[model samples]
Each structure stands twice: as C-alpha cells, then as structure tokens.
Target: MTLLDLTAPPSRSDRLTALPVAIVGAGPVGLAAAAHLVERGIDVVILEAGPDAASSVRAWGHTRLFSPWRHVVDPAAVRLLETTGWTLPDADRAPTGAELVESYLLPLARLEAIASRLRTGIRVTDISREGMDRTRTRGRAAAPFVLRTQTADGAIGEVTARAVIDASGTWHSPNPLTSSGLELLGLTDVADLVTAPLPDVLGRDRARFAGRHTTVVGAGHSAANTLLALVELSRSAPGTRVTWMIRNASAIRLSSSTEDELSDRAKLGGRVEQAVAAGEVDLVDGFEIIRARRDGDRVVVVGSRRGEVVEHPTDLVVNATGFRPDLSMLREIRLDLDEIVEAPRRLAPLIDPNVHTCGTVEPHGFRELTHPEPGFFVVGMKSYGRAPTFLLATGYEQVRSVTAWLSGDLASASTVALTLPATGVCSTDIGGAGCC
Candidate 1:
C-alpha cells in the first residue's frame, strides 16, 4: 500500500489539523508520548482502559524489575515531574512494579497538564478514517481519525483526532500452551487450573501453588522470576513441588562474559541455574504440549518430549509463554507488518528475536514505526510485536520521536538517540516476554 500523504492541502479551515492527538493507553510509554507532545505545545488526550493509570503494569506489581530507576524514567517525564515537586527515586535501586507505578508513572499522569487531558476507564475498540474504510484512499490523509471507545458504564462514544499513537503494550494477550500456536485442547474445561502469566506465586496466589504440584512453561526473565519465587515458597510449604518446562533443549543462558551492563538481569538467570543444580526444581527440556484435560481435580497435560508422548498431571499450570499485540482493533487501519514477528516491516529486521538480543536492537524512530496509515504509530512493547526483551528506556525514545514528527519537527524525529543495556541470552525467546 502507498503511504498516506500528510502534506495534502486542507479544505477551507483545516479542521482536522486543529484536533487533539489521541493517545491510546496511559501506561509508561503512552504517558511518555503525552509528555513529549505537551512539551511541544500540541494538544493531546490520553485514553486508559483501566480504572487507574498504568493498570497493566500494576497487575504484576509484585514482581521486582531488573532495570534500575535511572534507565526506566524518560527525560521528558522527569522534566514534567520536577515541575510538580516530584523527586526521582534512587538511581541505583531496582523497584517492584508497584513502586514504579507509585513513584513515577502516577506522579507524571497526575500532573495538571496531564490529569486534565487524561480519561480512565475508557477502552478503545476500533480505529479508522473518519468517514471511510481502508479501501477508500481519496482525501484519506486529511480526514480526521475516528476512534470507537466504550466507557466504564457501557456507554459507547466516538473520539476524533488528527493523529494517534498506540502505546498500548502487549501485556493483555498471552501465547497459549501449544508450540504450534493453536488453542490449548480442553482449555475451557480446565480453565480454573491455568493461571495467567506472572501470577503472585508467593503472595496473593500463594494458596493455589503452596504445597501442590505446579508446572511452569516458558524460559525467560519472567519464568526465572517465578521459579525463584516458587523455590522460596517451597522452603516453607511442605509437599510443594516446582517443575520447569521448555520447548528448546537449552533452558536459559546468561552470558558468562560479564559484559552485561544490567547486573540484576544476569543475576536472575544465575539464580535459576543454581536452583536447578541444587535439585530444588524439576527441569524438562524439549517438551511440546499436545493436549490438556481435566482428570478429576488435577489437570493432565499431554505433550511430546524428544518424540515420545508424555503426560504429567499437576494441580496448577502457569502459562508464561510471552505476549502478542491485540490487532483486532486496528483491522480497518492500513499497516505494513512482518509476518514472522508481527512488528513493522522496517523494525522486524532490527528486533527479530532469531538474530538479535536486547542490547543488539539499535535505536529507531518515527520512520521505522510508521504504517501505511498516516498519523498512526505503535510504540513501546506493542511495537516490538511478538519479539521480546523490550525496555522502557527504548520506549521513551520512541515517543520522543513520534511526538516530534506529529508536531512537525522532522529533524528531531529522524535522529536516533537511545542506548540499551547489553544482554547475552542466545537468540530470541518467544517462550517468554519481558519489558522494564
């Protein structure tokens, strides 16, 4: 598809250009995008589907992050927070997801400049041109973007914007148990036994996992965190057993090169390896899940391990198999996405997990993020598509460029200015997802 022309002369008053830029999600990246737009004197409205700001991050608030405060906060966000007497957290310390929300995101979102323009409990369902579908191209560039939104009270509304930045992260949609990407067999019948990704295994969800057999499927920082927590739980709760399963033969690798700038991230992998050696957890390599069904009170999981079919019955199963962007909402909008990774065609090559690590992904900007649809961008974790290892520092740079381009500062948008932490986990890990 041909790119939409942004320079087409407007009809009469140019009403579309006067409208505010609509930003989806009030998460870290979404708020960062708003901060940049506000700094440029561009009107903006932030729509958050949850009842409070940064709700998705708060869902896994119990888990501590590997990245330090210095690497997580955006420069524009800091400038905005400093105005309202908000001080930065200790740069050397890592915080739990809850601390991140309370210490930074909420403070930035509550600023008068941001709070007045923010609306929570507003879920956007669809996006498209004001008066036509993707098939209609004439005058599309100048047409105001229309958004279909539903409020907390079930009231539906339409929001019009000159541009849209979809910083909605991929925390909501999780990969299923099967390696083939098909729905888990008999999933609905055994739904109660399956827990969502990143559950509070040692806290709120402790009773469900304590003193019972629990199987964790995936191999990434997220899985590492849960295993460590579960191992700790086993110490106190008798009869508690933890099992680790992975699709590949090698469970997880932390570069022994010591070149990693993120020490805490490396430590997580090291801790898991130690637990496995101590025999605190059961490790099953090269397992492909074929089916799952309810067997009395326990759920029986059937899979092929090294070409031999195996069945394991457990009380609980944690699906930590990473995440994917929810693209159903943007079906009417034109997009150029890579089939393998689902990221933008220009960006997929740079971030494809098959070839690059977290530190290997170079900085990208508006040009790499744009689709055939003009004034539309997918920033943050969602922008990386199915590929993992997304960082907040990277996202901060994304919106800085996206908002710059939207505000007509082409030079700033084209310039790349971002540096990420070095990591040494061989190849991409679709089995696990992470963002800090």
Candidate 2:
C-alpha cells in the first residue's frame, strides 16, 4: 500500500485514505508526528486536551531538564523551525520545562503547516473503528477510526480519521500514595493536603511549602527535585521543615553525581546529597506508608519500617511516586500490551527498567510501537507504561519511525537510529530509575 492508494476509489485497501490521520495530544511527540506527515504532504490533524501545546510540561516549568537542548529538540522539528528563522538555543545549555515550551513546542505549534491542523481543548475520550467495535474484525482495516472527544465547553463530539496516534502521556494519571499500589486508608479526607508530582516549590507554589512541614515520598528524579527545592525554601523560611521518605534501606541510589554522564543531572544529585549530609533535610529510609489521615490542620502519616510501626506528622505531602498510563479510554481498541510493563508487548523487553537504562535500550521504530489495532499507535511516555525510562529524544525517534511506516516507507521505518546518555551506574532499584 502506498500514500497514493489511500485516496483511490473504494478499493479493498484504499477505503481509509478518505480521512486525515488524527493525532491525540499536542505535546512534543504528537507535534513532531504532525510535522513529519505534513512534510510528506499527508493529511493530518492534532487533538490536544489542554488549551495550549505542552500543557503538561508547563506544569513542571520550574524544574530544569537534565538533558541539554540538542537532546530534547527533534531533528525534524528543527528543520521546520529553521525555515521560519527560529534560532536554536545553546546546544550544551540545559533548559527548564518552561523554556522547552516557549522556545520549542509553542513555536512548533504556531508554524503555518502545523497551526492550521491543530485543535486544542479537545480531549479524546475514546477511539475505535467506524461502524465496528472491538469484537468485529472483518473489514476493520478499511474502516476509518472514530474518535469521541469532549470539548472544554462541555460539549461532546466525534471525529473520524484514517489513522490515530495516541501520545496522550501519563502526566494526568499519577500513581497512588501507597507503596503496594493501592489507595491508602483515609487518603480521600487528605486529598487537598496531597500535592501532585513536580510542584514548583521555589516559584508560584512556594507559599504552600514556606512555613509548613512537608513530607516527600518516592525515589525517582522527581522526588530528588522536590527534596532539593524544599531545602532551598528552608533557607529563606527557617520554620519550613522538609522530610525525605523512601522504601529503600539506604539512599545510595539517589546519588550518581561523580560518574553521571549528564552534568546537570549530576548536579541535581549532588545538591540533594549535600542537603541530606548537612542535616537540612530529614531522611526517613525504609518507610512504607500504609495510611494517612487528617489530624487537625496537619496530616499524620502511619507506616512500617522492618517490623516496627512508624508515624510522622506533616503539613503537606508530595507524592512523587511517578505516574501510570490511563488505559480506560483504550478498552474498545485491540491492543497487545505487555502484562507487566503495559507497553506494546514487543517493545517492553527493550525498555524494561530491570535490565535496561535510558541509553542501553536499543533503537526501535514503527514495528515496536504498532498495536493489534491497525492504524493505531501509542507513542511518547504513554508507550513506556509504568517504566520511568522514557526520554524526549527517544519519543521523537519513535514518532519519526511511526510516521514513515504509516506513509508506507517500511525501509525507513525499520532503520532505527538513536543515541542516549548512560546513567553511569547500572542496576539501581526500579523506583530509582531516571530519564529526561
């Protein structure tokens, strides 16, 4: 099948060509997919849940990304931007999430080729083949996809497309507070006391942590960033106290400064280590939280360490335990997902955090991202499922290959090419895995 066949008369393989390809989520990867398809003169449309591009990244705008400009910027996107007189940032300089949106995503969305095809504030609630549900597979490939969407104004509507790329990342669905992956007791009553991952402590959200005793849980880079920020807040507001909680016996996994390949990432780890060593931040190791409830204005966190029960009281809690993909909307779609990783079955092994680091995962393209549902793909962080090893660069490579395959360029789709920075140390516990 070729691009030309898509628009041909009602042939066995050309029925789908009547509709444009639809991409869910206007984040970096989704936008890149649009750029690639547009370059090929293929019809494409982008559906974004938020009012603007990269809204999720904007929430963490205060945090600086460890990867430099060169690593985060997509090659295809750069080509499009260059034509509009866009000046690239310093290749070696690391940018905060805000810079990433303003300097790259926003500009990309405004491009003449992409801007006209983009639609914001349109959330995709469900997707399936037109005139056919999951059970009916006969002649499914020829049918266009039906996307159910909810608009910002509360109106619901449907859009049809020849293909779909779901880049709706995991940012909206965060993991629970309990260590066992179940909801903690009394969690509901203290919902307001719990903050999302990547709160801007030193900026807009500073007042929330200024004079309060904050407890931060999890062992990933998100947790590390929060701990560092709280320590900085303590200097200006001496009454503010910060506690770092982890399920591990030791925090050795938190520091890879000396040998880290990325200097910015190393610096973050170094700063976190210094805070712990200076006694500026309380370290609660081996703590497995089981319950949290409101105690007047404060929250009482109860858990166990070893065989002993431990309780801690704090004014606020930041659950930086990472996020999981929202798979509910995809129930009607045929998918072959990994039982554990929740990623595409074929791609799970390559990105399994148990055996691979960010840089070690081999290059993959359309083949790994494709699902049992033809003309459907889940790219970007959502494709990683529960794994914390997804980088912006890796996502770019994924969409690049996916677009090539959709355009019937099988040879280009199979030719994998990507390079990522090593974590320096190997075999860190799953919770401590890091990525861009």
Candidate 3:
C-alpha cells in the first residue's frame, strides 16, 4: 500500500495558476482583498484564526470610530455587498466597531463569494514556499506556498496556495509595559488586573473599572478613549478614578482645529485634552514603567520619571501602549523590513509618525508593498509594524492595489487613487476607533 508523506518536499508539479490566493485574515482588509480578487475573476481563499470574521475588531467593538461610513467601506467590498442588497450606513455618520462589523463586515463575509471560500477557526502557524526552504533561490517564485495550520480543535492541517497575503492585524499582540519595549517585570503577577487595550468600559467590562482606580498607560487614542470613559464612569459609580500615563514628557493631543479634515478625530482628541485639563484624569507624563507588582489585590506600577523612581498604585492597569506586528509565523519567508518601524523597507518612511502625519504621506501601491518574496505581501495594520496611526482607508487602498497586481493588472496596481485630505487631528482607525 502506498502512503503519502506530508513532510516530504514539494515532489509535485507547480500548477501555480490552479491554486488560490490565501489571505491570512478575515478582518476588513483581508475580506476586502477577497472581494477584489473575486471581482477580478481570481480564485481566493480566506483563512481566519478566529471563529468569526473581524474578531479583532469585535474585541474592541464597543470603541467608537472617528471615520464615517464613507471612509470605512471598501469600494470593491461594497460592490460585492450591493449585489446582495446590503444597505450601507449613513456616509457621514461615524460607527462604533460593533456597528461596522454588524453592518459591513458580517454582511460582506456572508456574501456567497466570500462565505464559500472562507475558513474559520483555523490558524496559520507558519508559511514558506512549498518543497524548498528559504535558502533555495532557484525557481522559488513559481512554487506554491505552503502553510502549516492548526485547527481550533487542536488538529494540525496544511494549506497550499499560489500566493499569500497576510492581513492578520496586530490586535492580538498588544504592546507590553516598560520603556524599552520589553514585557513588564512581574506582569504575570497581576495578569488578572491588566485589561485589554480597549475594554468595554461603558459596557460589559464596566464592573472591572467602575468604582476603582484605573491607570491607563500609552498616549494613543486607545488610552484617551479609556480615560474619557472612566470620567463618565466616575460620575455614576462615584470613586471611579482615572490616570493617564505617557513615556514622552509632552502629550500629543488631537488637533481641534477647524481646518482638520476628520472632525470626529479632532473632537475625540479635544475631549481627552479637556478631561486632562479638568483633572478628571491624573496625567503622568514622562513616566516609563519598569515593573508591575501585586500589592494585596491591587497592582503597583513602578517606573522612572526624570531619573527618579516612582510607584503608582491602581486597582487596574490598561496597557494601551499600542501594538506591534508578530513576525514569528513568517520567519521562513524573506521580508525586507525597516529596522526601526519594522514596516516593509520601502514603505516605512511614508507612514512614520515622527515625520509624516495625516494627508502628508504619499499615496502608495503595489510597488511600495512588495517584498523580496514574489507572491507574498503583508497588508493592513500589521504592515505598519511598530508605527501607530493606520487609517482603514489606507488598508482598503492597499488591498485594491495588491489584488490588482495579483490579477496581473499592473496598470491598476500602480495607480494610486486615494489620498488623505488636509483635514485631520488623529490619523487612522478600525471602522472608527479614532486614530491608532
């Protein structure tokens, strides 16, 4: 009897065209890519690690988005949804993460085109060119890509495709405490106390922070949202205190300027600034956390502020310090990433928050997103690496361009149609979590 050896090298013909493009996420960006691929008459498959599409977005579903429906919807995805008679939300009104998922993402995923090709509860553990490892260069571009996967049931599986697009976002890999970007000391000791970056403060997670001292670390919109929510909680719960911590001495608040394009973002920023000014939140700037240790049931955050060591006590800590990409799965694939930002080498400078913000960054397409590997590309927020401020519009445009290239339409792939208008305070969001 003949038996198949899954571990054996390729030992197979390369009918690359017969295979589908494997998208490594089911979030907005990943589904958008699938929509574009279907419209282009290309075969595609979507692999989502979660049980539901946009699970990451759902995790922060309660947070309101600063972007309205117009900027939030992907053109191709809308077209696909329209065929099914889906009604779009008001173009001018912003939506919360839950609203976007229920109104847009869930419907898009339910569409026959996406639903038939989508696979859920399956996690891609690692990926590499089939047959040959990264060391081999000969005829590597034509080989089908192999993905080692694990089912939610703990069963291992394998999936092969002609190309792979990783839209898997950085939501799962939240940034840890500590100034140097390492996991905070004694984090495990108070694991139960560190809440998710954006908890349902006004909703289900209310009891966790309702009448307690909550210290939120980070300077992004995630922190701001929580701070403001805590203020609201304080009014009702009484004794519900708030604290905002930042590594930089000066906080970069959203511009409330009328000239800013995204007015909602400005309003969010302004609200945070107002909350701090009103002393509704204890603002601790230049505070770099070194450790988090348990004190009774509460946690004490130890840090250094201007060469002086300090300890801040809190009933709970929210590490909204921002997220970083997880590159562990793609180690076998060759990636040309920027040293600092960790974005694709060529695209790093364009999105760097230190130099570029809002509409100032140039419109980029396939050329900027391509990596050393022929058929592999990383799109969505994960592509931004350590850099913050990724707008949903930017990701929609990315998938459009990537799918165009994948379908062999170089003309459309190179064309950059989207640009951020001058109006802006904060830069980006996922269906409107403000920027970041």
Candidate 4:
C-alpha cells in the first residue's frame, strides 16, 4: 500500500465543496479545535485577532495563572507536543500567563497539525448567516455562516463556513466593580487612575510606589495578585503603603470546597493575613466607594463602610476589578442567552457529563453554544462569565465533543480507543518523555 500525501493544498474551486469550520479566537480552545479537525482529516480554518497563540496571555503578560501549568496545558495538546519531542512541566507548578502561552500554545501551532490553516492578525468584526437567496456572485446557494474580518495587510475579507466557534478569553473587556455591588466612591472615570500596560506592582516599578499610599479595589485573583505584589514591593520600598478596599466583608474566596488546604480562597485569606500583620496593607471591608476627586497631588477616596461614612487619602487606585465578554462580534447572531450569566443557558449540558469531541481529544465548553445554531460552539474562560476555575482539561473535553459532533460521530467519539500499538507496548516506549 502506498502512503498518501495528506498535506497538499486543494484546488481553488475546492473551496466551494470543502467542509469548512471557522474558529474565532486562537487561545487554547480555538487551537484545540483546529488540532482536532486536522487529526480527523477534516478541513478547518482558525481566525485569530491577535498576532499569535498567546496574544491574550501576552496582553495580561504581567500576571500568572491561579492554577498551575498542569491545569492550563490541554492533554491532547500535550500529546501533540510529544510528537515534537517537547517535555512538559510538572502538574503541581502553575505558570505565568506569558509562559503558558509562549511555551505550550505557540509550539503546537508550528506542528504539522493545523498550522497552515491558522490566520493571524485577523479580527472578527461580526458573525451571521447569509440569507439563503444571497449568491456567491449572484447565482449560488447562500453560505450558512459568514465571518467578517480585517486582515493584517489591511484587507477586508469574509469567510463562510458550515460552523463557527468562539473561544475568545476573559480579556475581551473589563468588568467594572460597580456592576458587582460596589458603589461609585466619587471617581467618575476609572480609566485614568493608573498607567497603561497594567502596572506590575512587584515588578521593576516597585520604587515608583514606594512610600506612597496605594488603594486597590476588587476581590478576585487580580486583586489578590495586586495585593501580593504590593506586599513584596513594600519590603524594599518602605515608603509605599497599601490599602485593599472591598465591598464585601472580606476578600472574595474561591467557591470550590472540595479541598481543605489547596483552595484558592484559603490561599488568598492567608495573603490578606500576612499583609495585615506586616502593617504594610489595610483591609477596609464593607465599604462602598461614593466618590473620588483629585486634590492637588493626592486622590481623596470617600465611601461608607458598614453604615458608617469614611474617607481616605490615596496615591493610586488600582481596579483589580474583573472582566466581561466582548459580545460585539455576536451582536448579529441570535442565541438563547442567560440574563444573569450573559452566556448561553443551554451550554451546561454539553460539558455537564464532560464528554469528548473529535477535532481534539479534550472535553469542551459546549454549553456556551446552547442555541440551535448547530456547528457552532464557544470554549475557554470567556464562556464562563465573571467566574473563574476553568481548566485546560475541560477545554480538551470540549474539543472532543465538538469535533465528534462536527463529523457526525458524537457517541462513538466519547469511547477512548483501546487499540494497542504494534511495537510500543507501553506509552513510554514511543519517544518516551513521560507524557505517557
């Protein structure tokens, strides 16, 4: 039997008949989707708004993930990495946002799987189905879905596909704390409080904040990280003072109660304890920021805490607030949305049991694809709303289910293959770097 050349490009006319699947946002989810399709011999096209795989991570490059490297690396992606002889990091060690994207995501794209299919620097402006009567030059069947995008070369183009998936992450947009029970503590415009590129408090700029009073608002991982950095900064820059102003009675803790020691809430609680004990930071809880105004060189933060009004003089206000999904692209596609979560209400069922999909060997976050808009799915943190705790493993499962659904093989796809390798009896024998 002769080996087939699977990498040849199809003729231009083949575009009319190619089973095209378009994926938006090239974070872990979109990349996983692309890998899955290629593995199944399906044609896929991935449109990424950024320059590369971890652009979103690069945007928040200054920060590290709450979970370790093990949680962020997609299992199927790991297998693909093994094919290229790359050794993965240990599961216990969490990587920074920059390392996760640069180390894992970019390398996978360079592999034979789905490399040519990726279109970078392509921003998706809108997604919608073309009318059935609309023709490809006046006399053809209307495409099912169209993605309007602007290319890197300043070229505007449209890609029509049988299905579309949105894997854009949390940085789509920022979520103001005011939306989550914090009153305006007198600051009208929150954008001007800090400098751009997001300050790395513990980074080289530690000297700038030293000996100065700083106010941090919000209670998520961002706030926690900010506080931790400030604490470290205070040690060297003894002139810097830190204050964590929260609307809640205390720092917001992680909801997972499964672990007694490793829970995020517990860790954060400890950080708060250390900061308070050191006298470098103050925790002013149960306070609602009422207003803010510039008085010469300092900012006056006024609010009411526990029914008592209070005011504080500050140097800077860092909003470790939160993020929201930028749905501007989906403003055209109509789907059943949850009023509160603002995600697809039907998305829960797809990942509820955590089944696999075809294009990738991971569990997917298909719940975000709740509408009857078959062939479409949403994965990654953006699909989860303001809540965190998404694992890359969950994204892999999502890809498995989605690819299976795409290829019309969902049920059989869930069952992992039991076939034995002819020579490599154990996984380690085949270029064993321990991924087995």
Best by lDDT: 1
Q: Write the residue-wise lDDT of candidate 3 on 16-60 in tens digits.
A: 888999999999889999999999998999999999898888887
Report how far off residue 84 is in candidate 1 (Å): 1.5
TM-score of each: 0.94, 0.93, 0.93, 0.77
* CA deviation > 4 Å runs, candidate 1: 4-13, 252-257, 419-436
* lDDT per residue (tens digit) for residues 1-436 in model 4: 1111212211223443474888887877788877777777778888888887657666555665545566556666677788888988766665665676678888987776667888889998888776532122222222467889998788898889877778876564665545334445455554355432235676656666777888887665466666777888877876778888878886544222334223443465576677778776798888777777677677777777778878777888876665556777776665555555555565433322123111122233333344544455666655644433344455556676667666656464444331211111000000000010
Per-residue lDDT, model 3, residue 21, is 92
> What is the Cα-based TM-score of model 4?
0.77
Model 2 Cα lDDT, one tens digit per residue, 300-413: 999998879888999999988877889988888988889998998889999998776565777777778877787889998889888776766778889988888788777787
Candidate models: Cα lDDT each: 0.82, 0.80, 0.81, 0.59
| Of candidates 3 and 1, the better by lDDT | 1
Which regions in candidate 3 have their CA more than 4 angstroms from the true location?
A: 1-14, 257-259, 419-436
Model 2: which ten-residue window has the lowest total lDDT?
Answer: 424-433
**Model 1 worst lDDT window (10 residues):** 424-433
Clash totals in order: 0, 0, 9, 33
Window of ten residues with lowest summed lDDT in model 4: 425-434
